[model samples]
Target: MDRGHVDAPEGLLRIEDCLDADGNVVLPAGVTLISLIDRNIANVGDTVAYRYLDYSRSAQPAVFELTWTQLGERLRAIAAHVQRSAARGDRVAILAPQGLDYITGFFAAIKAGTIAVPLFAPELPGHAERLDTALGDSQPALVLTTAAAADSVRGFLAKLPSARQPRLLVIDDIPDSSGADFVETVVDVDDVSHLQYTSGSTRPPAGVEITHRAVGTNLIQMILSIDLLDRNTHGVSWLPLYHDMGLSMIGFPTVYGGHSTLLSPTAFIRRPQRWIRALSDASRDGHVITAAPNFAYEWTAARGVPDAGDDIDLSNVVMIIGSEPVSADAITTFSEAFAPHGLPPTAFKPSYGIAEATLFVATIAPTAQPTVIRLDREQLAQGIAQEAGEGADAVTQVSCGQVARSLWAVIADPATGGELPDGRIGEIWLHGNNVGRGYWGQPQESRRVFGAKLTHRRSEGSHAVGVPADGVWLRTGDLGFYRGGELYVAGRLADIVVLDGRTLYPHDIEQTAADSSSLVRRGYVAAFTVPANQMPGATTQDTTEQLVVIAERAAGTSRSDPATAIAAIRSAVFRRHGVEAADVRLLPAGGIPRTTSGKLARRACRAEYLSDALRLR
Candidate 1:
């Protein structure tokens, strides 16, 4: 593949041309996020940028509000403090919980010319390992945390060797420096903005090196794709700040010069109604846009807001369900459950995104309801999405919409690295200005993951216009197909289980297992395959892979007999997918591990299971 530079369109801004003699970035009209923040502060200083609720305060929630001007001032002060210890291009890690402090620290790192590494706080359960992995990978010079978490962070750092420990700065302790003179660091569009660590659901986490240009362009693409420019868009979110989706939901609204109301994830998990209520309240001023993973919708649907009365109006809400498998059933159930309260079916927007692309990929248009396609299961397993007959064995898959106009998407054969036609299942490949530079530090891995090129020519299919002959493409390890001009995600290539010369998706098996019994926790089951040789009793002739199912028991359940639950799971798996599990293990609540973004960490769970670390009943 050719690696020569291709001439871009005329009038297109290049990062190299925007630098000054001192190597500092000379600010262009509107190139970087810093420019956008400055514009928002100057034009709409008084407009609320963020409103957060602190449920830890009292019986009723305590609210905190930050306007654009206040946020900018705080960011400047934090930036000054951060610059005292770290130089430009250094990495600064943020370990604070979800609150204003975390937000300030994040933007402050960017303002100081340091790549911000957003990480879950050490206080969160099961986060120590992930935080350790991130810290070692990013090698940040300084760590930022809230006062409440400072001690905990310090204690965690004490466990690490002195050479690897980083200086911690508590955001609450940073003094006000509005009157102090501080030179704002210049920012280039190509400057490394932040390192967004992938949620290691399938593999170990890697820091995705996102540039200012990518972030700015992605925010623009999202605004244009969702048509939020002309509307009065207010935001509400219950997602954790560490995750990209959560950050974008809050960060993008501010970039678009709109207000965002944030609720703690704990609050949402405790009472799913809090999320709906926040959206309902925010809609009074303007239209609300909120996003969450698929399970949250099912959780809210299971616990309906029966007492909300007629005050709950989701008519002006664009609810985004993403970050995991998009379930048509979940969308239908959530819409039907809240229809009495004025929630329209069109409000449901199914989206597909990853951390590598700076979050906002393909999302259904705001005007249309999510499109669901019914395909034969057998055909789908055979790498072909054929429409099922009226009474045939069909599975429903939701469309994630056409690729954003700013980005180019193609389905490619993973083994051959050749582009496949539409309706053929293959790996999803993405190319755009929004794609990140590459993973941090791991050059070999980075090139392998981000430097993909399609070698074969396609005679028929929807192709990206103006794609360079040798442009680099991002190989999204996901398997999907394009049908009806929209993208339908099948499953992760690594997660597909091959049994008896047939392919099976883990989501289907997990869904069946969850539906088998009420005692089983939804979204807490993991299905994976183990080599036959790794099983307790297997011979060399047993070349077939062994299927292992690990599920979490629901709370307050008296199902002490594992046999009953195991039998139920076996029966369900056999009945639904014509497959039998080689092993079934049921553990107590919170048994299965999950990423900070609430995705099942199947690879991690499998590792623990093989090591006999799981607390089996």
Candidate 2:
């Protein structure tokens, strides 16, 4: 297989070979992000990567994101300690919220070349079981956590086997003579970077192994996509770092002369306008780049663009839309709402990617105006992306852009494993340097995903060096089509709801309600199958499938008045998805279980629903 190279139209993406036909890139035994940042800081002294309003200090303080030199000092301290304490290559677990400390601890683990396992930071209503399962699956030797979060996971650890228990390494600022290993600073990237566990609802959370080389490659891909490194653009982000986007999306952009504004999803969801205000209030004069899922835009559209407290302009903001499937209406709604504040319609960059692909595979270039197609909703919901034109009630399909300059995207028949043609909805497959190594330790499933490689048109001749062996591809579980050199997403093949010969993706239905009138207005609603038998080990949401909607009221609106919200959502779902909601419950804003990185935890939300958590008070 040929190692592919990125040849972006702009001179921004020049590369010196980006492929390894041998299927393995030689990497140091146990590298970490600490090493990378440390090297950068040591080499380039006094370069700021983050600046923020220290509410406690009540002034803008320039936090050192990295100055190569400072990074070296910190990582050196942490790496030396970890390397000295290797007990059969002990795994270190990070069970803390997002902060500088979290980043440091993670980098320390990487510098030690120790496997870093990140537990989802969100409070899963019934996550103890999942956490216990993950702990057992990874069988870590040590765990690093904050005080409060450590308190929460303490009891959960007791449920594990005595021989398999992990040694707790807490990063305590408020110390009480607790005798746990405390990581002060991470120093290297030659270690196993991290083991990001998938959110396990239907299946167990698989750990995806990452290395220093892999992480570096992924970060470079992100920089090229957004041009953050070129001409020195700045970034403002609210994405959580635990997920791929948080790790790569915001941080990588901030690595080279780019600054980042960090906020938790809960923070942004609580005040949809904060994201806008972040961009408007930036002190720097560079193209502001950032990203959020479709729901974020819907939330802003619902809350109504906040009055720019200080003549805030978002026209220069290049907001990337990805994570979940991108919806045309949600982007349009947000673009129109914030347009008055100088929010450019082109700034709504609709793109496609996932965690398996390291959070970014393709993006609608830095200045390329977001291209959207109006398509037939009925046809689309049924796996046919017949394009429609500008009109009332027409479904807007946004292009996710072509494959990332370093990545390859292919639409294939789910059953036949054969590549499909443009405009024909099928499973979206990916292959490239950006593709992550298979899930950690779960070799069987990993082979099923990353190991099952495939060839594309580019692989036919000289490009054949990189085509996956055995006609395999990254099973995106997403349904989409290619047209006019751009990608238009239909729905997720994995989450499709096939009813009475008609097909629909749960996200599509959710997007419709999120985009349309205020029924769901800035809220969360989902549809899942509830089997008629509710039998143990029952798979698929078919035959016994039921739509369950869990939503948060708009900001400032109390959940106590959920009657109106529920009614609106119920009516909208019925009208659009043709699937009646089994029940609609209004949860407090931010109540929905989300991924560590702030993605709506639909399965977790569904679990809450089935347990009467979706009921009105």
Candidate 3:
């Protein structure tokens, strides 16, 4: 395997430059994650590697701390145990919560030369279906979890068929052993590292086959893009370990030789202030860097500033917002609410990424403020991003940022498979080493999604420009446009609804409805399109598709007057999006389906609605 080297553009620091006078690269190229951990132990053994906290236990919220030396020893011991049953290339499922144990088990799987499948613990109701499906798909040789979750994991696994059952191992019960005697295994850069499962928002979840090369390259891209090298960077996160964002945060900091603090997702949700407080504390030492989805910023902003008088300091913090649609209003609200607490507007970094691209594709420059544009709604419906004056016809969009210097992006017409001009909304196509190999056990899908090529064609007053015929591009399935050298994501191609020859994005309609009524639950609404024939009060001549919205009602809200709620939703959709929903279903809280990453499962919700399975009021 080749230890790929990145040719950093002028004025940018190179990864190899982070070496000593002896020309020893701090993080050697082609090195596995285990090697990174060992190097950290050798260099900074006494430094804290991870700190896990559980706010549920008010008496003792601080759970545990692991130093570099201790973490290396623990992971090696777990690796030895795993190697006894699993061989190189075998899959090992990790059904653990967000804690130090999950991190140890995951790295240990890598050290044991087995593919790690990180999954959510079966503590939540209705998560068994998802767990069972993942187990049947991956067919792991063994499962690893913490002592606290081992019983729940076993109970869920008992219901599975005998053929699909996997051996269970508890990390906390593993006896301590000297890892120095353990034999180290060789792992190649091109070898499979793990299977990152998709969110399954629009379809059934499939495993994305990610290689060590992709992981290493993406980490380099992110580190360089954010200019974290030689900087005082402290990592903090509240995202679940199962998601790509969370996994990258934990793993990337280790590779960078930095300390990270983690908190449970439930704790963060229960008290958003804890996340802010963690950042404030970390800022006392150095600049704090953390990442979360867009909804987290909204949730924290909604909590309002505490009355404790400017106790929090966000001046030395860089908050990355990604993993979902970037809301301009959310960014504005968060910045304004925290400004009194010393939060700078430029600290909020809006980014764009996906599981297929390993993790990060692009992020705004650290010194620049995030770009938010208001475009004409009518022009946007026609696949153009013309600027609109201040009025109700303007649609606000936040730019994900410029493409990483190591990667390339092109906007392509989905229908024609040809590249589109800048500022035109179309499918996003990416090309870079960070892109994953393909989906696991899915040859057809891999080829179609990862091996896409551009088709050259001539049009009026334009000559055909041929792209390299041998180069393969990753079809991102996301619709966006380029403006001023930055990417602005419009919406997903699969979630676009067409009505009366006009294109409408579900996010726009859902946002409008959520803001229309206080009773409707924010971020819990889903919008999709159904055939005109399937909707009542529509004639056969109505060739246009009908809009359908299913929104969850806030808890403790009265459902006795469904008619009024339905009318309000309809009015909001028409007033904002210029289209009326053919049907509006107001369901109780938790009625709408969401993926493990907290993304709206529009396709699943649509399926349930069509089957009359949704609990409608």
Candidate 4:
């Protein structure tokens, strides 16, 4: 095993510059995550490596701590058992609930030199099909789970054919003494580490092959970009362990030999205040680093901030808002709501990333406040980003900031693959060492998405490290543009609804519809297009796309005349976006389909609406 070193820019902090507790640089050149774990165990074995908030049996959360030595012992014990059943480079599926066991199982597979598939338990509602798809694609040789989740794991596996069923291994059932028999496996920098399946927002889930080099590089990139070089940096997260952003919490702490406190997603959803309390608690020791999607910030501001006590101090926090479309309104609302509790405006760091790049791609600087600009709505519909003066005809766009230090990004024409200059929206293409190897079993898709080359010549003024001569760009399907050295995301290419030769972003329409009626749930609307034949009355040769809005009615809200609410939604869409809604379907709360990471699944909702699968409120 080799320790990796990053050739950071002159003023930037290098990977070897990140010091341990005694102010010593222990990371070497070409280090893998496994070697980092060993380094931490040797240098800071007594320090707390992970702290999990367990709320399974009580209203108040109980904290569980794992020292570096303890964590290493558990990893070795679990890896020894995994090595007995699975060989190197084989897939091992982690089907445990979110907690310490999930972390143990995931890293243990990596330690055993197997590609781990981080996924949720089958008991998690509304994600059975997603889990099934990922499992079918990966076809793991072993399944890792906790004793409490063994029954659900078996039940889920029973639905699959016997040939596809994987051997089950209980992580907690293995004793710590088993580590004595553990044998270290040699792993290369480019060895496949894990398979991060896409969240299926735009399409079906595909296994993105993340390598050891990618993981190590991305961790360093995140550390440098966020400026979390202090030894006392603490991370607090409530994200699901399976998602790409959530999995980053594990490696981030290990790289710096810092401590991370994790909370389950259900715990935070049930009481958003828990996330706030966790951050406040973690801030007691040192600077706090946290992240969540835009929706969580809105939810916390609406539900958690009002009830927060006066002693809640968020002055030392740096929160990253990512994992979905960044919302300027959400950032403003959250900052204002928490400002009374000592949250600074600069704490709202909006980032942009994808699973194909091993999680991180671009983010605002650690100390900079999130940038928000209002663009002319009409011009934006035609693929322009002109700033709008004081008027209602403007759409607010948040800047995702520059690419990470070692990564390069450019906006390219989606159709021609030609590079687009500043202020022009196109598919975001990225090139870096952190780019994933490729899709697991789809060579054609791997080449199409992860092996793109710019059709036009390169442009100057990139802030990132120079790309290798053989580097190929990974084409991110999300649309964005560059302005004043900052990247501003527009929307997904597939989710755009074209009506009468006009391009309309679904998020813009969905926001208008949600605001049109108090009965509609915010962040719970899906705006997409239905074919002309699917609409009530249309000719087969119309060849025009009709806009459809599916909204979830807010809980405890009812309309005496539902038609009035529908009329308001239709009127608002036309007044704001200049488009008439062909159909507006309002359903009970939780009607809209969402991915596992809580992003709106517009394509899936469109399929349900077309098939009449949703029941009206």
Candidate 5:
């Protein structure tokens, strides 16, 4: 009932800030990929750009602060190094975790007009094959790694033949090589900025070309959507920098917004409580605006039960939940569980976005706190978002905040591609400047999501996208509906179930299991559909009956089997959403396939589940 527009962003923070006094955005004729973020932040001058957390055990080790001035110099140094050691267009692969040097390496690659590839170190196991493939495909000029992870890369490189190997550049374990002479370099917008590998939750990853426009557009929209312009905002995130969301939200936002950003990987993992605690630590000065998936909230929520109000304080947290289906129960649990510690329910920000659009697509305002709609399962999966009556089962309404400043979204029929009316469930299509260029090597795949073309009409201007048919609309392949000027996500359409003729979104069952303590981690459940007809012995009844959930048993809980987990999950889903989940697997940690960024790799997990190679203990 209470709806109000968030105050309009003032000057300096606007995307136009990248422009000069005359209003020219880029630096004329040719702007290199690397200098885009760095130069813009530098134009503002001496502003605290990035704050790196130094957890070195050395007695003298302390937190290192880098400003726009230092960042410029660091970039220059790396650019100079690029000129001596590698070719301009050659790819420079970052083989490490997220940290100060990672940002420095990324900017340096862009500054020198070289394409950079950020590979998550832990995900290397998943990419062993892709690493081999990338080595042959791109023939990277150099591989950069931190001191700790350098050996791992070295060992992997050792496995490859010397002819196909890339030179290694260790930041922490640097040899006698110098990296501070080549400062002068030229770059263009069309030039490739970096190469992004596919999510790679399954087989080896494939390289995707990420141009400067794609990366820049993502950062521009993220800054605007999250209100990063507010001078007081201090970005804090546990997201891994190797991933798009992690790199853009935590790294790019700092450069674009001209605010101090704190980076802490250990503090976040060792004690998830530290995310809120860190904000609490910084609260006396100004609040911290941070982000993470809904799972983080669930992690902290469990802490509330044990710790209660003993030392938790989340007054300074504005946790933006996304990168997966947003959970309403997780929001309520996080909000209510932290109330005793001064955290308001509104601090929970449910959002929607994907890597193709950069990172953020739409973000809600801080006005109504968080709103969750308890909707009927049948009506929702049938492409409708009807609000169930008090007696009807419903989903929590922690809506992903309203459309970000300049973005547009529509729910469209998956097959016909026609826009659906409000309250109708369908794949949500997003149209905006934030949309990425396309996949790197898979033009056909790119055309699949981005389509061959799209057409759009708005005050900003109408335009065509892709070829003839790939116009203004960008199909997100996500199941959701738009109503009352806000977007509500149901789940992925491919992950839906049409058991016994009634449609069901995977999220409906996922949420039902999450609401119950009997299930594993709030996100321990992964829903996917495999063709039952594949079985030579199966019939039409089995073929049409798709959907088998792979639910990781909550740590330490007994009742370990697909039968128990399935029955419990089904009965609950049947009671709540009026649908039945065919299978609910209870596996240990890391049993389910998750993308390097930790998203559920339902498709891959399903393949593994059917292979019988994946066993449930």
Candidate 6:
């Protein structure tokens, strides 16, 4: 915890500013999140801490604001009730819709000194299994929900085994006056503050054990990285609060005493214009900062921003595009579409992060345009990142930006564990105070993923500043490379498809397949590999792997023939990547598996395909 004798990055805050030698949060003066909240209350209590845009019952949005003092009072009151049913270090799950109550419940669990598990409501469609799996894995001692959802929540809990059901508390029922009876609990920076569950795109959802130290350090790191330390930097987000990027959007504003406007993910999906309108409103007060995935940007640019008209002002907005691979085309399209509405050329920020790192790792500079590089497709497949020559087979990649101040990221060979030089794609291993402790309740897997070490490398560009003294590193399971001080994320290591000694990125294949036919849902395609023996007409000697394509037909596409779409996809895959699709399955809309955050769960889809569980058209 001491992190002794390390050189701090120039113009960047030290990690020790939040974590002391004893690993206890530097409190009262306001380094940690709780202390910052308390400090904001003491200094600017009347300032708005949160603004919830509610659209639960009507098309018109009803906005509600909570000042620091009001937020503190409500959270403390709910925390008092939570403490009655849960103990310190115990898991307290928040199973509620996104709104004021959900935000209050999350802070209430933390205020009660319990490990907060932010989860979605059971009523959310297509995620019942995920909810059950998370509940079973965390085994929370208490569950928090709103009065409006109590009955449905109770019925959902009743379906679980008696031992797995946690005591449920309606957060809306708690009176603000009950804050008087609450007792404060002293928490160390090393204490586990929350359990951030992974999206489970490749495997089951595993809760990342985020300590108070990691959270505080990551908040500071992000604040510095994005130049959001200004008091007037406001936040607007329609991302789900349960997700890591979404949580960071809220945390960043709260820690820095800036106002944050939030709405449900469903609201944004229903009408992305809401997010655009929120940005316009937030920018009037100060510089607006927001974050979203690549697809959201594409959808909003194509649908929402085009309809925003002349009155919207986007001059002071800084939007962070992440959570999935950043698409250069999306950035260009979005920027061009919004430029007439006072959007700045440098507004688009491409970043790379994970839940294990408490959200932020690297982001584009505030005044720089989103960078894109074209790599030779063949060289990229061979694990190199050299720029492609003119008229060559090129793959465009967006730069994820430089590493944060206090973090050290090294690209190391996944097999040899040796650090790779610049322009070589490899697993991204990270070391920083911002890294979480590990996965909750799984020691072996935790150690395997979080306790990595770099093989001693004597070459240049291997050793870097901010390396942990313990020599431990976090294996991100993501494949990327460092080029000219910026990180270029290639793809996921597990999601890589290998055939004939050439590696293929599933996203590229999926994109190609989607573009082949208008009836295919663009973002709903999944491309994976299956053993040749698993497919029909495969002899025992055919031990190689074959490519499989699964795509969803767009809704209301009865006029478009499914066979034609399938034929186009097969043709496109063969033309683009020189690989014949051994099997192409056409399904109805929403057939592909997706994580809670709307990411394509490729591994899960492959399993379902193998099991013949897909609802093929």
Q: What's the number of clashes in each of the models?
A: 0, 37, 0, 8, 35, 0
Superposed model 2: Cα runs more than 4 Å off: 1-35, 50-66, 87-89, 120-130, 146-161, 172-191, 199-204, 249-259, 266-274, 281-283, 300-316, 389-393, 453-472, 511-519, 533-592, 611-613
Task: Tell me the deviation in Å of residue 110 in model 3.
Answer: 0.4
Higher lDDT: candidate 3 or 5?
3
Candidate 3 lDDT score at position 122: 94
| TM-score, structure 1 vs. true | 0.93
The stretch of ten residues in a row with the least summed lDDT in candidate 5 is 458-467
Q: Which order, best to worst by TM-score?
A: 4, 6, 1, 3, 5, 2
- Cα lDDT tens digits, model 2, 498-548, are 764677677666665555435343536555655534523445554665666
- Could you give candidate 3's per-residue lDDT for residues 1-617 as a string of tens digits? 11133243232234665444753223345666666677778876777889888776793477689998889889888988898878899999899988999999998998889999988789955456677777788899999998999999999889988998889999888866746545688877778788888888876777888887778778877877776664357788998888898889887666656778999888888888888888888887777889977678878888635557648878778888885568887788889888888787778889999899988888898789988888898889999988998665888899888776557778889988887877789898888777889987889999999998878432531112323566788998899988887888888899998888899888888888888888887777999998876554456765567789998887668656767778999998997877878889888877998778777889888877767678542
Estimate the TM-score of every prediction: 0.93, 0.80, 0.91, 0.94, 0.84, 0.93
The clash tally of candidate 1 reads 0
Q: Which ten residues in a row have the lowest lDDT in candidate 2?
A: 1-10
The list of candidate 6 runs beyond 4 A from truth reads 1-30, 306-310, 468-470, 535-543, 554-556
The regions of model 5 sitting more than 4 angstroms off are 1-47, 54-62, 122-139, 160-164, 173-180, 198-208, 252-267, 304-313, 452-470, 514-519, 533-542, 558-566, 574-582
Give the Å error, residue 240, model 5.
0.5
| Model 6 worst lDDT run, 10 consecutive residues | 1-10
Itemize residue pairs with steric clashes in candidate 6.
Answer: none
lDDT of each: 0.82, 0.61, 0.80, 0.85, 0.64, 0.84
Of the two candidates 4 and 5, the one with more favorable TM-score, higher being better, is 4
Model 1: residues with Cα > 4 Å off, grouped in runs: 1-30, 304-310, 536-543
Candidate 3 residue spans exceeding 4 A from truth: 1-14, 17-29, 178-181, 390-392, 457-469, 532-544, 554-556, 559-562
What tens digits encode model 4's per-residue C-alpha lDDT throughout 1-617?
01133232232224655435643333345578888778888877888888999887798999999998999999999999999999999999999988888998998999999999999999888889999999999999999999999999999999999999999999999999999878889978889999999999989999999988888888887887887777667899989999998999877877768888999999999889889988987777678899898789889988887463446878788899894569988888888888988787788788998999999988898769989899998888889888998865888899988788767898888899777778888888898778999999999999999999776645565422355545689988999999989988888999988888888888999889888998888889999988778754455766467888988888677544567778999999999988889889788878888899988988788877877777542
Q: After superposition, how far is residue 456 of candidate 3 from its true place, in Å?
A: 3.4
Mind giving the per-residue lDDT tens digits that candidate 1 earns over 1-617? 12123332233333344445743324355577777677678877787888898887664679999998998889888888899878888999999889888888998899988999998788888867888999999988999998898889999888988998988898988776731544678988899889999999988899999988788777766765676653267789989988888878766754556777888888888878878778888776677788888778888988747574447877778888885569887898888898887787788889899898888779888678889888898888889988899999777788998677658888999999888888899988898878899999999988988999888748666465457888888998998888988888888898899998888889878888888987788878999998867765556666578889999887677557777888999998888788889999888888898888888889988888777788542
Candidate 3, residue 307: lDDT = 58
